[model samples]
Target: MAGNGSFWVQIMPAILFLQLLFRAVGTDGASSFSFANDCQYPVWVGVLSGATSPPLARSGFYLPPSGTFQLAAPSSGSWSGTFWARTGCAVDSSTGRFSCATADCGSGDVACNGRGPSPPVTLAEITLASPGSGGQDFYDVSLVDGFNVPVRLSPSGGSAGECRAVACAGDVNAACPSDLRVVVAGSGGVVACRSACDAYRSARYCCTGEYGSPAACGPTNYSQVFKTACPAAYSYAYDDASSTFTCVGASNYDVTFCPRT
Candidate 1:
């Protein structure tokens, strides 16, 4: 079973070690990732290595209607990166090449091949257990780059409270302002929403320049809107303390796209 908590972790050390040693991915084996699609349509899942950490076994792939994608345990070490999905993608009949309408990684294939995806993407930012962070795995859902899909994370093979699931409910994109809205061709239905930082690359919105510090740029109208819509997600860069979550000891995780209602 999986445990969910909203508060920060202050668990005992001994128990924490047990939790870490006994996780699905540990000395027993490497960490693994399970990707599930709960959306009404197909989605292409992409995972990228952060800071060129040990790359994921399958960095990119496709999940058909209600499909699931699995990967072997990751190599032992500190690994951090982002995972997201691409929508409205298909292969060109003549070229037989892969392409996505949104969140395109420019790989021209199912595999991202070390390329970064386009904006308006929902991101599952994660850091696996390492010496620096007391061997805890840190994870979160970030809307800072905008939102293309709804994401949820959970430590599935461990006891409850071991980790908290992060997911945004409801369709905030449909209500997204005209300026920030990403709509489909002709349909005019919302597909994704862009963050102010993404929409306007300025020091104020990017939280850089004189506003580089958290104290400088606390919260803007755009960030507040995102926070109000998805309180558990990283609406801006400084939302860690509240939006970020941790798992002291646990196995692998489940990254769900279009998470359950």
Candidate 2:
């Protein structure tokens, strides 16, 4: 035939160069080993042996050297580290520090600046009294551990006077005053009421059990005038005008006594 086609084309180029020398020594010559330029030899040798990269994610919100991780408003001062994804982080207004650079990745607007100090306004503990000579004045405030949340005692002006007294006046029978001279304070001191008086004269002071009728003064006309002058021990008085009353525990605590006029 053409000498057997030149002996099968010289044995097919020596069996295709021994199958390219056993594929350069096999495992397909480690896919032609590479070194960079978009690397590719087992993923650039598993990223130079430290294996693949892309890790480091932790930010549920905790930047408290003093406070201020998100929008900055916890006294406006003191802050700390770890904010990566594109790096470029900074902030050190004198001492409230925060930094980033080494092996960074910290993405966008990584925050933190000079911030800290602003959250304090809670005052309560008032006291004022004129428990009754009359003009119906009484305000003795003190409430500790009594109102945990829902509280709204707003009387920026008049008539809030007695903070709405309720608690003693003979358990709601009303008509108080046995020389009612109450004066308790709170927030941490002065609350001596060792029975100076108040056996019961406080239905807000009078719906009468005795006190010169004007219906014994109840509908807030406030005149128990000390139950008509210390009926037995508790007395009440109010009359600013002819609000009407004659309660007289020896009458004279500066006597104006609720006549309301």
lDDT of 2 by residue, 1-261 (tens): 999999999899999998887665432100111111110101100001011222112222222222222221112111122111111135567855544321112222232221111101000111212222222222211111111111111112233322231111121112222232222233132111211112344343333455446456532312233223222212223323322222211111110101121
Q: Global lDDT of each model?
A: 0.80, 0.23
- Candidate 1 deviant stretches above 4 angstroms: 1-30, 94-96, 130-134, 157-162
Cα error of candidate 2 at position 125, Å? 68
Candidate 1 lDDT, tens digit per residue, 20-134?
Answer: 7666344522267888999988999988988758777887999986999888556566778888999999899999989997799999899998988899888888887752234
CA-RMSD of model 2: 35.9
Query: Can you give the TM-score per candidate against the true fold?
Result: 0.84, 0.14
Kindly give the stretch of ten consecutive residues in candidate 2 with the minimal lDDT sum: 41-50
Clashes of 1: 4
